[model samples]
Target: MFPMQFALKRGMKAEMPDMDIARNLDIEKPRSRSNSHNEILTKDIAGALLDVIRDLKSTLEDSRKSLSHSAGAGCRCSTTGTTLSTLDEYSTSGPRSSDMMGIPPEIMSYVRTFGHEPATASDLMDWLTEFEDTMEILGLDGQNGTLDKRSVVARLALKGKARKVVLAKRAWLARQGQQLSWAEVQKSLRLAYRAHIPEHAMESRLCRFNPQEHSEEGTGLLIQRVLEIMNMGESHDNEYRLFYIISTLPDDIKDILLRRPCPTDEVELIGRVEDIELLKVSMAMNGREQGKGRKR
Candidate 1:
C-alpha cells in the first residue's frame, strides 16, 4: 500500500507542472450558485437551446404539413388527434394551469368602483371588455379552466350597481334551484340598467360631469376624467364638446392654453390643448434640469 502510494505520488509529481498550492488553496473553486442565479443561467441556456429545438420543430411541422397535403394547420390537436407544433404546446410539465396566478390591480380597482351610476348597455359592455382584458392578462381565462365567459358578467352583477335587479334575480334563482348563467345575468343587467338619455337630460348630465378631485393626483387626471365624461354623454357634436372642454379646463392648464393663438377649427383647438399641455410638461422638465444644474 505504501509503495503504491509513493509510486502514484511520484507519477503525479513528474507529470504535472509545479503548483502554488498555498495561493490556490484560498482561490475559490466554482461554488454552487444560489437557486435564483441557477435559474437565470438556466433561462440563458434554454434560449440558446431554442435554435436547435426550432430545427427539430420545423421538421415535425413540415411532416405535419405534408400529411395535411401542404395546407396550414391549427396549433393544438384537432378532433382527428393531429397536433403540428413544438413540444411546448403539449407540455403538461412545469407549472399547472391553475398554479399560475396573476391578478392586476386594475381589475380590483374596477371591482371596487362599481355602484356609482346606472350604466347603459354600451357602457357596461365597455367596462366588461376592460375587466375581461385584465382577466386574460392574469391567465384567469376560459382556456386555463380558471374562469368562463359568463364568470365576468356574474362578477359584475355580484359586485356593483346591477346588484339591485340583477343580483336579486340571481339570488332568487339560486333559492328556486334555477341554475342561471353569466349570459343570463348580463342580459338581465342590460334590461334593468340600460340608460335612455332624454334630450333635456343630456345637457343636465353634461352639466353634472364634475372632475374627480384626487388629493394625490394633480390636473392631469382631472383633465383626463373631464375628457372621459365628455365622451360618455353621447352627444354627437365634437365641436360643442371641444369648446365645452376648453371652457371647463382647470386654471393651470387653461392659462397655458390661453397664451397660444387658438385655432378656429374645434379639432385643431382640441389638438392644441393636448399639444400645448405636453409642451408645458417639457418646459417644466427643462426648468427642473436647469435647477438641478444650478444646484450642481
Candidate 2:
C-alpha cells in the first residue's frame, strides 16, 4: 500500500508537466457549454409561458367586464318590469268611465260670463273639447259635479239650456225682491273686462270719452255712467285704485251686472249733491213765507 501510494505520487509528479503542457497547448476541454443549448431552450420555453400567462390574464379581464355588463343589464330589466307591474295594478284599481261624464254647473256659469250672447253649440263643443283634454291629463274623469256652489251666477243670454237658466235665475231674483238695474249691468261688464285692460290705458280711455259729447262713444261711457250712478265718484288720484275697487266688488252686485235686460225702478234719476241742497232750500223758503203770513 505504501509502495502504491509512493508510485501514485511519482506518477502525479510526472503528469504535472503534461498537465502544464496541455494547458499551454490550445486544447479544447470537455464543455459545460454542451448544456447551453438546453438552457436556451428553457429560456424560450419560459418566454412562451410568460406570453400565455399574459394572454390568459387579458382574457380573464375581458370576461370579468362582460359579466359585469350583463349583470347591470339584467338588473335594469328587472327594475323596469317591476315598475310596469305596479303601474298596471294602479290603473286597474282607479275610477270608472261612467263617473267622469258630468261637468260642474259652476264651471259652466263661469264660462257663460265670458260673453253676454249665448254660446252656440259649436262654441260649447269647442270649450268641451279643451276642458276634456285638461281633465284627461288630470285623471279626474267619472266624478260628479259639486251641487252646493250657488254663487249667484247669471245665465248666458240665449235659448235652450242657457235661456232656461236665465229664466230660472230671474225667477229666483224676483223671489229675493232684487231688481237688475243698469248700474248692475255696468258693474258686470267691468268685472268681465277688468283682467283684460292695462292699468295705464284705463285713464286715457276715460278721459277721451266725455259724458256730454261721447255718452255713447264706446262701452267705456256706459261704464262711466254706471260708475256715477253707483256713487263711485271721480277721484283725482290713482285711477287703478278705482279699477281695483271695481274688480273686488261683491259677488251679488257682480251677478246683477252680468244679467241681460237691465231692470227699472220708477224713481227718477237724482244725484245727491244736486238734490239734497235743493230740498233744504225749498223747506227753508216755505217756513219763512209761513212766518211772514202769521205776522200780518
Candidate 3:
C-alpha cells in the first residue's frame, strides 16, 4: 500500500479498536476482552468505519463528476486515473493571465488620442503630458520592462499620423538591429512634427501673450502657456521669459510684483504672482462683504 493509504488505514484501526483491521494492517493489537464484548464492539466499530469510508468515496465521486461536467471550461483534467490526478490538474492547470502589461480602461479613456495633421508644439506637449501620466499610473514609467514591450504598448495609446510616424521610426530601428523605446518614440515624434516650427513664430506668440484676455483661465495657466511658448523658442534665458511674462500681467498686479525683488526663476515668479492674485481676490471679496454689512 502507499504510505498515505497505510497511514489512513492505521488511523482508522487505531480509532475503532478493531482486531481484524489491526491484524490486517499489521498494527499492534489491544489487550483482550470477554468474547461477547469483543464481538459487539467489533461489529459496531466495523460498521462505523465502513460508513466513514463510504461517505469519503461518495464525496470524491461527486467532485469527479462535477469536474468532468466542467471539463470544457478551459480547465485541464484526466478522467482515466485516480481522484488525486484530477484534483491536481484542476488546481494547477489553466491559462495564466497577468495585468502587468494591461492598462486600466479608465486610464485609457482619460488619455487624449493624437494623430491629427499639423501637430503643433503645444498640442504635442499636452498629449505627451497625458501619455506620461498614463505611464506613471500603470507603473511603467521607469526601467520596469523591456524597451520593446513598452514601445509596443505606448504605440497602442496613439492613433493617426502620430502612430504612423512611430511605426515607421520603429521599423527603421529594427533595420539597425535595435528596439524602439518610449523615450526614443517621443523624441522621434517631436522631431517629425513640432521641431520644424519657426523660432520667430514661438517668440512672437510669447511676446504677444495677454494675461488680461485669459484672466478667466487663472494666473497659473496663463504662466504655463507663456513658459511653453518660451520653451519652443531658441532662447533659454529665464530673465527674458520672465520679462515677457511680467510685461503681459495686468498693470495693478504687475506694479505690485515689480516692486518686490526679482524671483530666481520662472517657477518662483509664478508662485509669487499666483499668491498675489489670490490675495487681491480675497481683499475684493472682503470689501464687498463689508459694504453689504454696512447697508444691512
Candidate 4:
C-alpha cells in the first residue's frame, strides 16, 4: 500500500509542472496582444501627425501664392481692400488719362488720391506736403518745361471734386496758352478746400487751442495742430508763436517748459515738448508699477 501511494504522488508532481507551464503561457499571450495593440496605436498617431503636417504645408503654400499674386498685381492685399482697389484703379496699365499725363505706375503707387471727404483742411495740407515730398524723392520736382513732371504728378494725384476743379483750372490755363504748374495746382486746391478764415481769426483759434482739451489726441497731435495753424496764417515772429503755444499748454507742461531757457524756434520747442511728454509717460508707468509691487 505504501509503494502504490509513492507512485501516485510522483504522478501528481509531474501534472503540477504541466499546469504551471499552461498558466505561464496564458499570461504571456495577453502580454503579446498588448504589445501588438501598442504598435497599432503608435502607427495611428504617426499617421495623424503626418496628415496635420501636410495640411499645414498646403495652407502655407496657398498663402504664399496669394501674397505673390497680390504683389504682382501692384496692390497689396490687406484688411483695407477698398483702399487697395482704389489705388489699383490708377496703377493698372491702359491708355487712360493718367497714362497720357506721363505719370508712371511707380509714382502712382506711392501717391495717395485726394478729395476723400470728412477730411479737415489740416488733413489736406498734410496730404499735399506728403505728395510734394514723394515727388521730390522721385526727382520729379522743379522740372522746367511746358509739361512739368511735378504738374503731371499733381494731376494724377487728384480725384473727385478736387480733380474737377484742377481740370477746369488747367483747361483755362491752356486756352490762355499757359501751362498749369505744380505751384498753381497747390494754390487752387488750397483756395477751394482750405477754410477761408481771416488771419486774425486763425490767430485767435491758435490762442484758444487748449492742450488739455485735446489730451486724448496725444501731445504729438496737439503740437502738430498748433504748428499747422501757425503755418496757415501769415508767419508770426518765433517769439510770439512760442509764447502762444507755451501759454496754452497744460500747467504741468507749462511748468516744465518754463524751467528751460525758451526754445529758439518752433522746431526746438516741439522737440522739448515731445521730450517732456515722453518723460511724463515714463514716470506715470513707473508709478503704476511701484503701486502694484506695494500691493503684492
lDDT of 3 by residue, 77-97 (tens): 233232322332433333111
Candidate-wise lDDT, in order: 0.35, 0.30, 0.38, 0.38
TM-score of each: 0.22, 0.18, 0.21, 0.22
lDDT of 1: 0.35
lDDT per residue for candidate 2 within 1-296, as digits (tens), equals: 11222221221111111222224332233333332222111222323333433443344345434434554554222322322222122223322211111222333343343332213323444443332222221121111321111111211111122222234434555576454333433344344334334464644355333332321233333344345534655442223234323323233222223222211110111111122322233334455766898999
- Candidate 4 structure quality by residue, lDDT tens digits, 1-296: 11322221221111111223324223122222222221111222323333433443344345435444655566543332422323223233323332322233222222222222212223333443433332222222222322333233333334223544554664565466554454465555454443222354544465445555554344445456555654555443432443344445554444344322223223444444545343354345456766898999
Q: What is the Cα-based TM-score of model 3?
A: 0.21
State the weakest 10-residue window (summed lDDT) of model 1: 9-18
> What would the TM-score be for candidate 1 when compared with the true structure?
0.22
- For 1-296, candidate 1 gives per-residue lDDT tens digits of 11222221221121111123212222223334432221111222323333323433344345434434422344434332545342322323212221111112232232233332212222333444433332222232223232232233233223333335544654565566443443444345334333322343433343344432322133454355446655555443433434444444443344333322212233444554544344345345456766898999
Instruction: Please list the residue runs of candidate 2 whose C-alpha ends up more than 4 Å from where it truly belongs after superposition.
Output: 1-124, 130-195, 203-247, 258-296
Which candidate would rank higher by TM-score, 3 or 4?
4
Q: By lDDT, highest first, what's the ranking?
A: 3, 4, 1, 2
